[model samples]
Target: MDSTQELIAQGMKQSVPWVRTAGIEFTEISDGRVVATLPDVAEQRNHVGGPHAAVMFGLGETATGAVVLAAFSDVLDRAVPLVVSAEVRFTKLALGPLRAEAVLGRPAEEVLAELDAGTRPEFPVHVTISNAEGVTTGELTVRWTLRPNR
Candidate 1:
């Protein structure tokens, strides 16, 4: 497994409520990218009987944070990344299992450099949550900040 995959596996083993509750599982990680899946179950359903917006948001946040953490592992020092800001838009009602992916793309190097400068870099990660049909159910742009622990 690569560094990104290893990191995501470690995170899965130490699953939190937000992950377990939503049945979110890390499926893939590479470079500065992360993909997580969330099953559409009764627990994740909203009053309208569709996936709750909060659950989708949680998956996006988790995926984005994982990308930033993987990209700046040196600065993170195994520390957890936090979301400083996020903008989410619900494009359609989500039903069934959903996949959320975050990709750092080619800008990873520049973002890592900024983090190394110790200026508390805010990495903007794009998260796309889609249903089985590959239709995007929601989109989120999350800004994650990494803090090194002494």
Candidate 2:
């Protein structure tokens, strides 16, 4: 129900060139949560006929980025957002047409307060990748930061 999906997707496509070629679709986005999916095409599949691990990682990254953008929509022009790190675990064999859900792990207002105080703030975004049937396949935690623009 979030209207910023289009703008975030466009910005992602331009900023992360791989997104354009990755075939990721932004399905839903909200204040601090987002859902994205990968098509069941050959390019996104692995040797076992499942979604490739890297593709799944991409989904996690993209979905987390969407939530970051949505949560910090009010401070866009004053900062530069970046993913500082990511730790992902592939727990199961993922199927095609996979979906990834990402949620911000910290409060937006808290992070904003730190940024407002001239301190670059970092937060975690947790992502869960699942199959069409709602079975989770992987979990990823991406640490993101909003750096104050000089």
Candidate 3:
């Protein structure tokens, strides 16, 4: 809805080939929260006829990335954000359209202060995956780092 959100979403859609191929849409983006959705078409289904695991992972990762970028966009010129690690668990068969919501694990102010002190900061973003019926089907946690561009 905001300019930054729009720019980030548009830029990612164009720059990330896999994002385009998978039809991921960033619906909400703010300082510490982000939400993304994946269409539940045949192309997104897996062998079980539900949403594929990889696609769900992609949505989780992308949602987290957007929240991080929104909170740290000011420091991006000096540091490049990267995913250090990720862990995901599929709880149920993800049928129908899927939604992923992500939030920062730590306070944005604390993380930004570390960056201001010229130290690389690592933070976790936790995401919950749910189907159109509002039932949770997966959980994902991603550890992201802002490595200073030397």
Candidate 4:
């Protein structure tokens, strides 16, 4: 595992207060992939007694952001990673705890190459939210961008 990935995971949990409130757990963070788990807490449950849709959205977005940070770790000091937009489709109901895994649309190397060339690279991260039963509850495509901090 990359030290940068570890740093990103730590920073997200420590620095981002809202992310901490969502109770997201980073299970994996690699070059182009990230996995997170969101517990089915009572506060996060919907009226139907299932996990709320926003919980999945938050977990999915968190996982996608982790991948973006890990992918651009080399230039993170000079760049800012932001989520421009997200398109999520809720399919089945979230009956239990949610696990979300996000994958970069393009290879990490390719995204870096674009950023290295002075282009604001926008990456589409695909997230699949699944329940303990391995049933997919939602799918999200989050568009992330890396811009010069200055």
Candidate 5:
């Protein structure tokens, strides 16, 4: 795995215990975007044999949080990202393996600048969760804050 993926995996392994059970695997991580996958597993299925809504929401949050953290990874010694609120919508039943892509509205440079200036900035990350058939099954808007780690 690459450095970004390794860092994501390490974070999940060390702190986010629930993400592992949900099968949230980091696929891509960049300055302003992150992608993850939630495998279609029997353990995660609902009574109707489809992926549960919670799985998508959890993966969405995880994906968005990963991107925000990756965007601020360089300043870990001074600041950290925290999810203040999350709004999620379940559009349809997510079937098959699900993939979630989270995009940051602001570029990484702008975000880092805010942190460098010792300002707590909040940004919204939009996440779209799709199934193997490429149908959007859910959406998440996560508001994260970059603040000094106190």
Candidate 6:
């Protein structure tokens, strides 16, 4: 229930209505960190009887972007964030409930400066998705751009 977590929860509630509908739950949010969980159900499975890749990618990217957005919010006023690029790698087929976590890296100062200068800053965020056994099932790198709202 820290400031960043509060902001993330509020923003998710306001912006991503589908998250609630899909039963995606944000479990943690801290400084430059975020985690979300999604339950495994038949509806989310692919024709091959495994969790859909898009579902896994979506959860990872969204969770990672949320963390980056929260971090950038601390630097800029009226800043809007968007994902500019993303890459996902499936290390293993997800067969059960999934957990995704995003962790921030360096370049904090540069990102802040770009935000203050009204230049969109791109942050590279790493996301790891794990299955019920706590083994990593997938990884994603999402690039987010932040800019001031005109």
What is each predicted model's overall lDDT from 0 to 1? 0.77, 0.89, 0.91, 0.86, 0.84, 0.81
For all candidates, the clash counts are 0, 0, 0, 0, 0, 0
Candidate 4 lDDT, 25-136, residue by residue in tens: 8888887889989888998898898888777788898899888877777888888888999999999978878899999998877877888888988889999999999899
Could you tell me the lDDT of residue 52 within candidate 1?
A: 84
Clashing pairs in 2: none
Best by lDDT: 3
Best by TM-score: 3
Candidate 6 local distance difference test against the native: 0.81
* Residue pairs with backbone overlap in model 1: none
Give the per-residue lDDT digits (tens) of candidate 6, residues 1-150: 777687787788668876666578888987678898899879989987767998898788778767876676665457777788888999987888999998875466788787778787788889999999999999999888776788
Model 3 lDDT tens row, 1-150: 988889988877876778888888999988999989999989778999998898999989988988888888888899999999999999998999999999999998998889889899999999999999999999999999999989
- Regions of candidate 4 where Cα sits further than 4 Å from its true position: 1-5
Per-model TM-score, in order, reads 0.85, 0.93, 0.96, 0.92, 0.90, 0.88
The residue-by-residue lDDT of candidate 5 on 1-150, one tens digit each, is 587768876796468888877778887887788889988899888888888777778889988888877777787787767899999998888778999999997777887787778788888999999989989999999998888876
TM-score for candidate 4, please give it: 0.92
After superposition, candidate 1 runs with Cα above 4 Å error: 1-4, 12-15, 78-80, 148-150
Ranked by lDDT from best down, the candidates are 3, 2, 4, 5, 6, 1
lDDT tens string, model 2, 1-150? 444678887777888788778878887888888888888878678899998888889889999988998899889899989999999999999876889999999999999999999999999999999999999999999999999999
Candidate achieving higher TM-score, 1 or 2: 2
For candidate 5, what is the TM-score? Answer: 0.90
lDDT at 47, model 6? 81
lDDT of 3 at 100: 97
